[model samples]
Target chain A: MKKLWNIFKAGLVTDNPLLILMIGLCSALAVTSTVSNGIGMGLAMTFVLLFSEIFVSTFRKAIPSSVRMPIFLIIIGGFTTIVDLVLKAYFPELSKSMGVFIPLIVVNCIIMGRVEAFSYKQKLVDSIFDALGMGLGYTWVLVGMSAFREVLGNGTFLGVQVMPQSYQPILFFILPPGGFLIFGLFIAFNIWMKNRMALKAEAAAAKENA
Target chain B: MKGNARLGLILAVFAAIGCGTLAVVQGITAPAIAMQSEKALNESLKKLFPEAASFEDITETLKSTSKTVSFEKAYLVKSAAAPLGVAVKAVGSSYGGAAKLLVGVGLTRNIAGVTVLELADTAGLGQNAMNDAYYVNKAEKITFPGQFKGKYLTDAFEVKKDVVAITAATISSKALTEIVKTAADAAAAWLENQAAPVATPADQAAAAASGAPAQAGAAPTGGK
Candidate 1:
């Protein structure tokens, strides 16, 4: 249970994929038109990332280091194709809305990054845990950013009216520009928080030395 | 030295295999991808007119169908449906990129259907205009070739008098109405030259011809 908790904690913060590491941002901008879409993409991406990490870890030694990138790409692309076809066949409208992003997962940096950086070195079980942590981290950022965008842009949550009618939505928040604006603010906010934490740590150490 | 050369040879061979693998995958998926596109275009057309059993490319590039000496000639999309036979498309810059819609007509130019093939409007607002709401439910019955449909080339109503444009989308509206009008004029020119009869819209008659479902696309082709 402690291990599981650590996995969740690692993903949700400390190592949040998008905010801390800046990974998988293409679909972050593309599918974030709505909260539901954000959720859909997050879950689908998490699944692909998790399974591919597992597969890669199991065959890590068998794969020559030189050809690892190509092998990882094929794995990611094949999984993304499956997800794309399933969405197209089952949820046609959502499939249309997701559009080019589904195929684009083939190039998403995070999937390839995790496969190479973590799965390549880790044992299979360790790789699975790392994958779960990273996938959750990715999902939380999508949901969080989508939450910020939807509420401010449309004055709603998941499409339901959240803010009262009196609240005038900053309609631009949901547009393409909004994606960049929110991302920039979060980057600043994270830097500020990190600096504050470091300052407190230094003051505590200084007083102890004194 | 031998180790380095061996390594380089292995890398070259691996790179060749990678490219070959990509080629094979592309070859397999290309046909399926093309088929999906064909299905989507056909589906969009069918949604406009249930009677449209089939559609031919006719001319693929839309720029070739232009008339009225305003925009370049653009291509034509012909639909063979009766009673409410008509073509529809909006033209102009819809907020962002070039905006144009083209639809087909049959008898009475009473607005058979509308197609929004190109758009670059604000995603949630004007882009919403292209969704099933604006295109399918609200604006399905609008006739195209705004002026040529009802009025002859000898006398065309000003766009303000004849067209119904979506509010807040004036540029797109003007572009769309012009494309419709151009398609009408071009089709009329071609048809009259061939001595084939062409039917244009009669708004008052359609208003009286109620009892039919609310005309989805018959809103005047100009802006509010």
Candidate 2:
């Protein structure tokens, strides 16, 4: 259980796809303009990541290293298409808003990196927890970035007018530049938090030695 | 050689499974996707003509008469008692890509309403053209599409002249105006052609040769 928790924690903080590893930043920036879009994209990515990890882990031994890349792509691409079709059929509004980004998920580095690095060697149960952790880690950061962008950029949260009507929205917060600015701040904050925790851990170890 | 062949076989098997799975999923969602788009179109048409009880597609009829401007889709909007007007969907090239618009033209040659169906333009600039919340006239609370209501089909459709342009988005504004003009002109020509069916072939040829249909000159009777 502790090991599972550690794997999950790694995804959320120590090895966050966005903050630490810094893979799959394109969609994260592009879709973080709205809170709803962020949540929708994050969940959709989670679905694809979770499934791909499961398939890769379950068939790890059977998949020869020589042809594993193609096999991984097939699984990832198939899952992405499924997500796209399902969103179009059921959540047409979300499907429209996200546009080509959903199909672009097949190429997201986070999924590919996790599947290759962790799931390919890990057991089934461990892969499951890792997938969930990584998925939620990606989700929380997206939601955080989108919340800041949407609230400031559009003067709205999840499409509702939360800011006072008198408050003039700064258009800069919603643009591509704004996405980069917020992403930088998030990385900085994550680094600071990690540093603080490391210092505290070192101090505790020294105290135990004394 | 044997190892390579075995690897290829495994890859092919995975590819086959992936394709089969996608085919199944696509088969399941295809119908629902079609229905959703149709539903969306109907809803937009209803929004344009609020009192419209039903819509009959007149794309073929309109296509025959509308030689100057082409429309993607044309519909005869109708109420319970009588035909209200014609609605046409037209596309114009914007800065980024195609901007699709739907314009409803009343029988009195006045624009009933205008709606944007699809737009692939630059975000924050060109996209503000269709955003209702981004008002062109804050005091009047008038949206970009809102200005088109009750406008005469003969009015100048030039951006920054008769049409108000979005801030720093002249291309988007011009594209939308062009699409609206095309839809309105197509609707007008078709409506005129339908209204005056007794004209001789010579007169029809003259009208077509002129490249502009003669105005019906009928006074506005407030089409209910």
Q: How well does candidate 2 score on lDDT at residue A210?
A: 100
TM-score of chain A of 1: 0.84
Among all candidates shown, the one with the greatest lDDT: 2
Report the poorest 10 consecutive residues by lDDT, candidate 1 chain B. Answer: B60-69
RMSD of each: 10.2, 6.5
List model 1 lDDT by residue over B1-224, tens digit each: 87667656655655565566556666666666667656766676566556665443323122223322122222233447423233334354446656656555444333344566656565555564465433311445532322233444443434456555554456655656555555555443332332332244354234323312222232333332
Model 2 chain A scores worst on lDDT over the 10 consecutive residues at A167-176
Best by TM-score: 2
Go through the candidates in order and give each one's DockQ. 0.22, 0.69
lDDT of 2 at B29: 99
- Which residue runs of candidate 1 sit more than 4 Å off their true CA positions? A1-8, A162-167, A185-210, B1-47, B50-63, B66-102, B108-111, B117-121, B131-224
